[model samples]
Target: MSTRTIQTSAYGGMNRKLRFNGKMKSREIIEWLREAKQERYYTILKFDEVILNSAIIAEVLDLLRISSRHGRVWERVSLEFCEGPVDLVVSSLVLMDCVRHLFLASDKIQDDLMDRLSTALRISTSLKSLWLLIPMTEVSATHLGSAMKYNRSIDKLSLSGSNWENSDDSDSDSDDDTNDGSKSLRPKLFGKQNAGNSPVENQMSPRDAAMSLALGLKYNDGIQSLDISCCDLPDEAMAPIIDGLVGHPYLEALNISRNRCRIQSVEALGRVVEDDDCLIRSLDLREQSPHDALEISPLSFALRQNRSLEALRISHNELVDSQVLELVDSFRGNASIKELDLEHNNITEKGIPDLTKYIKELPSLTKLLLGGNAIGEEGFNFLESLEDDDDSICTITEEDLRPAKPRSTKTAKTSKSTAAAAVSNNVSFLTGIAE
Candidate 1:
């Protein structure tokens, strides 16, 4: 952790500003200095953490000829907290210098810090990539919308642990009734303020904002990758978001796992995948189950039109025999998709013949996940047949089928001994099978 010192010109034409460039190896210092100076003097200055102080931030703002106290230098700058509240203000001023990439993670973002952040967003037009790890939970959507309205530069935004719910126990009595209904489980809209509150609620759920921002990106051409996992959104909440993504040409990857999204959303998402102009390359919708069985008819429609999608993941759903057969059949003509994950489903031994029949039609199928299913020894034999060079229609080998064996067999008894023992054990637990 040796600190490397570098002298560079400050943003306001201040001479020989002392800045610490950490952990430079022995011979790389000269190359680093040359590369550092190759950019505009202001760009170099903004990267300098020493210039992130209030005096230097003010000087940089004035030098940029922006009169507002809230102006941005670059989209990103890191300032370690060495002091108190004043340091936080200095950091905000530095952030205001530009708005594209802002990574402000400190212990100070509690009550007053969010207010400053809202102000910063209002003034920072170029801000795109925002990673704020703060404690503030009551973020007003109006203020966030106001900030995002003029500023279209943000493509990736991540906010952690900001889902602040009401602290008052008065709402406890309403919890049971609210929890009883499926309608109450819908993802709550953040940034909407309670009546009479001047400041917006800090409890901006990341998933809610992610869905909004993703919808917003449909009009905006800059955003490409969106990761909103662990945000606590349900499948119903994602349906509209998926619908909004039908024609987006710029979006590439979407991760919406570990949320409450279910099979219905997946079914709806299949429509987006069917669009010819859709640019999605990877879609992750794991850990969401449908109220009923998962259907693959919509996915078959997607496979017919979507040529750009390279990977499709729909793990942890209750996929039945017919659904698996339909999905495998859909991939027969789809050469673009290389990876397919169908883990934690119920694709049985009875479905293996149909599964392999259509799987053999996919020439580009590289990685296949069939774990936590009921594919038996006969299914494995069918998979092994695909390993041969003469079986040019299928490219997967015995190695690809090896990892999926043990897990799928835990429930299904392959041998007579195991089956008899299982029946006996169940009988001892319950005398009548009819029970």
Candidate 2:
């Protein structure tokens, strides 16, 4: 006995949108296909991780073909933790004139199945978004990169959590929820080498995968948003990908968070932001390493010259007070950035004065997320006072407002003097930036 869920949404009394989830049976699928042929409704079908044989695949394909031949089309299809058989089903579905979005999550992808998927990607003209949250291999990465070079309809692509080195002997069974099925369950981003006959072929370094992807992205013109976070790509690998995205026509968002990108990657990213023709709006560098004053200098300098980037996220990257001050001073006359996320860093009362001054100067900055930091009471009070204005700051977390730990005498005296001046001068700062 299998459970199934079907949700329907009627739009403007014309066509219905139907979403089907859970493990479906053959008889039930046949009945649903018969009923769907008579109705005008779009379909979003999601398959649970069940043993899908050839018969199930044929019936599902027939159902999609019938719906597409009618006025109704399948909009999205998802397969969670399934294997090559499911991959073949979705690959066949992509060749249809339906399925704008496809999500496939698996523990392992064979070379033949990846070849089929890559062929479908190249031939599918209607697919808009493709997410392959699986343990990717070098062959699969090369195949997908080659496909993207010829693909023209895909707008959003995410290949996150492909840092898995080997898929052999790895268990795919899990009780975890697949709500946000893009990420993997692994704790570390490092790849593990497993013993095998073809050991070298079984291992796909994150950097190699990224380099293959860069080759494909270099020629792709239609991709708008790219997310390769959690892939453990260092500077050498990420530099090539950043070069591929240098002058993209429609690219607006890039998320490279949780990697090991160092000075070279940061400098390359700074060049991308500094380009006058750069149209990128959102840059997410969350949880990247070594964000001291020197490592962050390249980006800080680029921010002073960049006018296209709107949202910058550097959260949980171990930023200290001096780095925060450098960032604030860099954004003095910038007009584009609206959201700045500095949460979960080492910024405290010492950095709050410069932040307060910068906030007063940059009118475009509306939302500031400083939660998870030890900003202490003084920092909290100053930021809270600014909240009197509408839509000025995000809700400060309890950690941001909590009392600071005791500092050394000289540091405490300096922080206290800076904070008192900032607090007392808040009157003029508020007045000067008043509407």
Candidate 3:
């Protein structure tokens, strides 16, 4: 009797043949695509620093579309380019058809380039979120309105940049304009407000354009969170933007940290908070310190009126002990606030007593950050005393304040060496907030 044998192909043998063309790396990409096809989700597709040509991006988008069945339910897509023409024309039909979360970051974005991109985004009816990271000066009012025209599904928008301040030399000719046969180049404090006009209308400033973009999106129902951090916006520039948040009912989180915004802008924002129509739950106005001569009473007044805010972050501001006490006092009787961050402020022992009193009174507060302040062992002791007396304060534990054993000199040296090695290897230590 002769023995007969049967052989079966690998588990994904057919799929591999159909997609990968028998190469291992290509097969992996194919496998990922197949998985994405089935799942209908994509996230964090970071391609920054790579000089990809227009054709390559088109191919990538095509592959994404093929995997996603033409982006019917794809969730997140992050495309970052460091060097390229910000405007790269593709199949407009395909680009306009995408309905998903889109995040675009580039270093060389220009007004004209953004206008074209905005035109494409305007047609994406299903876009749920839009994040644009570019130099703030590059963004114009025309581009902003065009991008937001048809984007009704977007619920979150974040725009970040580093250098937004125009150099003084650029405005040097303004002094001569007043004496010459030309009109003064000074910006008007209050200009004609046109409901239908672009923010860039009538020689408006760059800051005005930014404010217009923010205000333009106020009526958009899909917007829930807006973060415009590190944009270098000064007090005068941020005034209109702060005022624009008045009627934004759906806005929950607003972050304007690491900018040049002052107490005056914050006070203006406080005015927005007083409006019942504003639904902002969290406000981050960190890293903006007021000049010594400026009065701090307005900030306290603003905090008192912002009853709906649940989280307040005012870290890295050089707040005096009295101001900190006043701020903490304002939060008393307000129950919505659950977190307060005053880190990096020069708060001392004098401020701790008032802070402790406020914390004890605020029944809803769960997280309090006083890190990087002058509050050392004494402050920790005060917190410990409060914890001991109040059993209801369950969130923060004694372990959080307990100091770890001091590292030995050798161990410290070794750790530093390891960190240096990691830096040399280009390893990133960036991590998101823990949920």
Summarize candidate 2's per-residue lDDT along 306-348 as a digit string, tens digits.
7788898887677888888788778778888888888877888
Candidate 1, position 77, lDDT: 43
Candidate 3 lDDT by residue in tens digits, 91-208: 2322555535554544332466566767766665656665555434435555665466456666777664322443321222212322224332112111122233233233335575
Whole-model Cα lDDT of every candidate shown, in order: 0.48, 0.64, 0.53
Off by over 4 Å in 2: 1-38, 164-201, 290-294, 389-391, 398-435
Model 2 — TM-score against the truth? 0.77
Per-residue lDDT of model 1, residues 191-246, tens digit only? 22334333333344434544554454445554566554433455655566566667
Off by over 4 Å in 1: 1-152, 157-215, 290-292, 389-435
- TM-score rank order: 2, 3, 1
Which is superior by TM-score, 1 or 2? 2
**Could you say which candidate leads in lDDT?**
2
TM-score of candidate 3 on Cα atoms, chains taken together = 0.67
Best by TM-score: 2
Instruction: Extract clashing residue pairs from model 2.
Output: none
State the displacement of the C-alpha of residue 303, model 2, in Å, after optimal TM-score superposition: 1.9
Query: Against the true structure, what is each candidate's TM-score?
Result: 0.57, 0.77, 0.67
Question: Candidate 3 regions off by >4 Å?
Answer: 1-46, 54-58, 61-71, 82-99, 138-141, 167-206, 290-296, 376-380, 389-435
- Model 2 alpha-carbon miss at residue 122, Å: 2.5
